[model samples]
Target: MGNRLSKIYTRTGDDGTTGLGDGSRVGKDSARVSAYGTVDEANSCIGLVLASELPDDVRALLVAVQHQLFDLGGELCIPGHAAIFEADIERLEAQLDAFNEPLPPLKDFILPGGGEAAARCHIARTVVRRAERETVNLARHDAVRPEAVRYLNRLSDLLFVLARVLARASGHGEVLWNHERRKA
Candidate 1:
């Protein structure tokens, strides 16, 4: 880490290409970059939710998730390098089960609002979905591991459930979709 960032502006990417962990440069719009970039965006959204009120266990889980996302991004940074472990995906699944156990079963689709924290969670959920799509696209064109895509898929589902949890914490329940209401 001694020489990690001696200079903030390298000026090397003046041509719009960035170096990968493997020391090879590619276009900033490359699939690999897009995959990890969206993951970073989702991570930021999750950070916003973390700044709001959340249960202790939920907070801890999101913190762990942030680390896992970093690992995932790192994996995408280097070709043929793997940073995500099977245990990471398994842990996400376990947390999903624990968080969803108490929520009432959904009978219809729902909107994505219920106060600030819950709304932030909903935003995070959409970003996670976009990250998943980007990862899947990267996998289709690159030699990426299947588990990376799997992790993003599971994370999206977890975010959805966590949004519901946040709504409950705010005593708003879920704002279920009202199809029978007046047309917009």
Candidate 2:
């Protein structure tokens, strides 16, 4: 980990093209770049969730997720390279089960609001889904590790469960959606 970004401004991307981990240049909006960029965006959303008061165990899980997301981004940036694997995806699955086990079963749709931390987790969930979609779009035309997509997909589920957990912990409760019809 030699300060890879010792000089953040390389001026190389000023021409609307950016360098990939393999030293190849592509348009800034290239599908591969967008795919990894969205992962970065999702990681930032998780940062918001981390800044809030939270249960220690949940916070620890999210912190590890941040590191995993960075590895996911690395896998995306460098062609023919991988930093995420099947085990990573399975770890998320285990967390998802552990977190969801205690949550009350859902009978109706829930609004994406509760306590501030839960709301932020909801936001992170949406971003992770978008990252998954972007990765799928990239995969349609290019080679992408299967685990990358699986990671994001599982991450959204984990975030949803974490949100519910945080909401209950905050005593604000889940914001259940109201399906009552209203006359316009």
Clashes of each: 0, 0
Per lDDT, the best of the predicted structures is 2
Stretches of model 2 off by over 4 angstroms after superposition: none
User: Could you tell me every candidate's TM-score relative to the true structure?
Assistant: 0.96, 0.97
| TM-score of candidate 1 versus the correct structure, residues matched by position | 0.96
- In model 1, where do residues sit more than 4 Å from their true spots? 182-184
- Quote the lDDT for 182 in model 2: 66
Tell me the lDDT of candidate 1.
Answer: 0.91
lDDT of predicted model 2: 0.95
* Tens-digit lDDT track of model 2 for 84-169: 99999999999999999988899989889899999999999999999999999999989998989999999999999999999999
RMSD of each: 1.4, 1.1
